[model samples]
Target: MSLDLGMTNAPGSTPRAPGRLGVPVSAAEALRYLTDLGMWLDERRKQLDAIDQAALSAPDQSDREALTHDITVSMALWKAISDRYELLRVTFDSGRVGPVQAEQLSTLIWGRLDVAPGDGREATRARMPSGAESNLAVSLPEACRLSDAMSSSLRARLALETTGLDVSIRVKGIRESVERIRDQVSMMPLGATRDRTQRELIALEQRLFDVTERAKRGADVGGFLGPLEVEVAARERDLIVAASRRHESERDAARARELITALAARGDAIRGLQAQCLAAVTPAPKLAVPDVRALGAVPDDPDAIDALLARLGLVGKALDQAHETYARALGERDELQGLLGALDAQVAGSPAVTAAERADLKPMRDQLAAVLAATPVPLVRARALMAAYQSYVRTVTNNGRAPL
Candidate 1:
């Protein structure tokens, strides 16, 4: 008798006793059970195809996601059932399908097929079993043959299906690749080829639409997505080249900014110290500093900028030494003489200082006074005398809090 099974309903079917679960008790019965489920799944797939056709224009993102998941899950379930059925058939043909073995196989098949996933449903038709009680969730009895929890007999391989090629996995991979390409297109920076790539993008999108329509109609998806994949790869290559050129241009621009900054710093240094250095020398060379502020015509090459800067003024370690000498000559003579006079007055009036300390400080003060009297005091002597006098003054003052 033909048995009608629902996810949640009276377990027995046809002339079977009431309240008894209608599980197949033999290999032949189990095979029939799986075959019936295969047919049922086909009908569900057809319904999904119809949904795809209906949602062609203005498809909802969430609905498409849901539909994809449903298709994937249903396909997986159908495959599992068909494989188990083939295994049973092979074993039965080989005379290995014993009573206990058949019962175990039947139970495994029922557990998988008799329950629907959470949030999944058949809206157009009512299932005999309500599908509320998931057979997968129910713990099978320990006494059951396949329920051993350890070293289970289900380790055997099922018969493989070789009659037809299954291209579902291929379609899934290509669709995922297309999705990654779509994401990349959005983030790609604008360039000379950007507008052209955008046009190619429109064509790529149309191909994806055609692929979807063909998939719904049960046509070959690989043929449609294959060319689309090639087109996508080409655009990605173009974008990479564009990005490389843009990066080189950006690097040149950044180098130009650095050149401007260097010029400004050198201008500040030259303006402050150039006159003093020239005045110190008997025969000074004529120096012409370019207008650093006007750089609209300057080339971006770093090497060229450095050459221009070097030619315009004194630089390198020699320039640094000159700057140091200029600063010392300009201020040391006057500043040291003023400090010595202040120390002399402090010494004469202080109760903290002795006559001996005053005598020791007098000679250094005289030397600084002699240097200041010279017309253009030699920078080297002034710097040395300035340091010597400063050291003596600090010793006499001793931080200004104790006797000298």
Candidate 2:
């Protein structure tokens, strides 16, 4: 009679139970157990593939040998289990199975199978008689357990190796950063700032040396590496920032020199225009043109240069305002002269007034002309005279009545 055998619900990563040796299990149960083991073997095959790839690509000779050994053993054991499992699966599916087939399947699981010797030269050279150096004979359960243990060991070693590689890469990066920062610091002008920054770089280098030594001695330098990188990066950034600011200051200083020359020339021209405008027109606006000299020479410091630029901007604005004011005053004087000329022509051509009235208007017209023609024309007096002349002409033309 076929007997029922307990199995895991799913062929997952859970450890398989030891096989029941010489136990009577049904054909159906044996098939199910074989199917589960096949699934488990497929998972192990993927893991073995990964280990094989890692072993092949390992740079270190010792690591490669150790990993290769584990990979070889696990793969050989896997092939043996897989080969036996497949045979049992096909035998049961053929529908020709009886007591013999069932016993064979049980024996395959619970019994030992001879794993072939490796094709390596080392194994071949060690070959001996009496099966002393022959292949291993282990049950399916024991094979799976051994493969799991090897996989775990390989993964752990790989993790440690990966960590060491990461630390080494970080150290190299820190060293490169230190060199770059040192170059930047050397380029800085000799001063307390440069000296202080150089001291900081020396300290960082010392700390990095300590970390490298500790790493060489197989100490965990993970905690120190991160902070060292941060400090080095920060110093590099600071040097870059300072260099940029220095360039800006130099540019600003050059700009200030150019502005100084331009502003001085402008001030001279504006002062001359002011004199001419004041002499040509009365009641001209009196605005103080900014003296660019009061700002003095541009400074070397960035902040001082910025301040000087701001002051130069203000001076430029003041010059512009003063120029506008003085030019406008001269313009108004020209406009008033034009208006008076136009009015004088209008009144002279008009026939509404008698010769006696014309003679009466002559003195007032002469006074207005003299005021307008003077070097410093009194605009208030000129306007009053022009208005009086216009009023007289209008009264005479309209004959004491408003024009329609």
Candidate 3:
């Protein structure tokens, strides 16, 4: 028999009866259910998208695995909900009946459906059906049984999905923590400890990649473990390297400071010596003396006169030695001054242009010429010359006939 499955009243107006199949549901109720289902699906899709985004942004293998896990779980949940909804729709469309039967079917559907609790207590209580006499009578015939089976299947699937999600979240959190430690430890300066730390991190990263691969293949969750051990080892090594480098730097700086201090002190001492030399070489002005008259006229003793002449000779020798020392000092000073001037000219890019300056110093370049130039010394040469000069001076004085 052909059944007319049509609602007697407006959508969501309250069913008059219960228990029947092929009864038209209120348009409003159907639209609300579809809307709620769409929202749920959208939310799940968003979660999946978020997971994908997170995986792309992850810096390491561990985080990527974690995001993969989350996405898988969310997809599973979405599939389960969609499957149940499709099954329900197919079952309802199979049979058709009158408005009364439709009202009864709507009641039955509501009775079996498990409405999720809302955040507001009053709203939850209002929307939720209670296990009471009137409400119990409003249940549809086959609807409860079908809904119970579907709910059971959904619950099982949800449990599995939730477990996967939780595991993935936990892995991601752990991976993030390990990564933070690695970053902090790696920043330390290079040394034995830093090298050790780097090795440890590399090892941990390898292990993490293995775990991620296993997870992608849907292996045992327990397989993803051990990055922590590697991170700890790396951190310890890094700390040691940083400390060693810091200590070495401090020691080097201290040595340099000490060297600078010592050089400065030595420079001051040299400057003092230079000042003393300059003072010693400074020339003193000569003073003029007036001639003194003899105290008294007396008869001279020959022995006393001889002693006096000997003292005069000694005084003359002393004066000559003093004059020679002064002359030598002056010559040395002049030589030093000339060397300074030449250095200054060279520094200014105008080197001295003289024959002596350009001359190349050579040892024994003309030995034969040197030997030929040497003259044989004449005995009493200086004495003979002096005697002749003295005689000439006396002759000239006599010729002049001025004064004896």
> Which prediction has the highest TM-score against the true structure?
2
Question: Order the candidates by lDDT, highest first — what do you get?
Answer: 2, 1, 3
- What is candidate 2's CA lDDT for residue 92? 73
Alpha-carbon TM-score of each model against the true structure:
0.32, 0.54, 0.21
lDDT, candidates in the order shown: 0.45, 0.68, 0.38
lDDT tens digits by residue: candidate 2, 192-250: 99989889989998999999999999999877875665566546544644554565568
What TM-score does candidate 1 reach?
0.32
Candidate number with the higher lDDT (1 or 3): 1
Candidate 3 residue pairs in backbone clash: 4-97, 5-97, 23-102, 108-140, 193-237
User: What would the per-residue lDDT of candidate 1 be over residues 102-178, giving only the tens digit for each residue?
Assistant: 66565554332322332234433222111212222221111111111000100000101111324454344335434
Query: Count of backbone clashes for each model?
Result: 3, 0, 5
**Candidate 1 segments exceeding 4 Å error:** 1-191, 202-206, 209-218, 226-266, 274-338, 346-367, 373-376, 383-404
lDDT of 3 at 31: 45
**Model 3 Cα shift for residue 205 (angstroms):** 0.7
* Candidate with the greatest lDDT versus the true structure: 2
Give the 10-residue window scoring lowest on summed lDDT in candidate 3.
Answer: 1-10
Model 2 ranges with Cα > 4 A deviation = 1-165, 348-357, 391-404
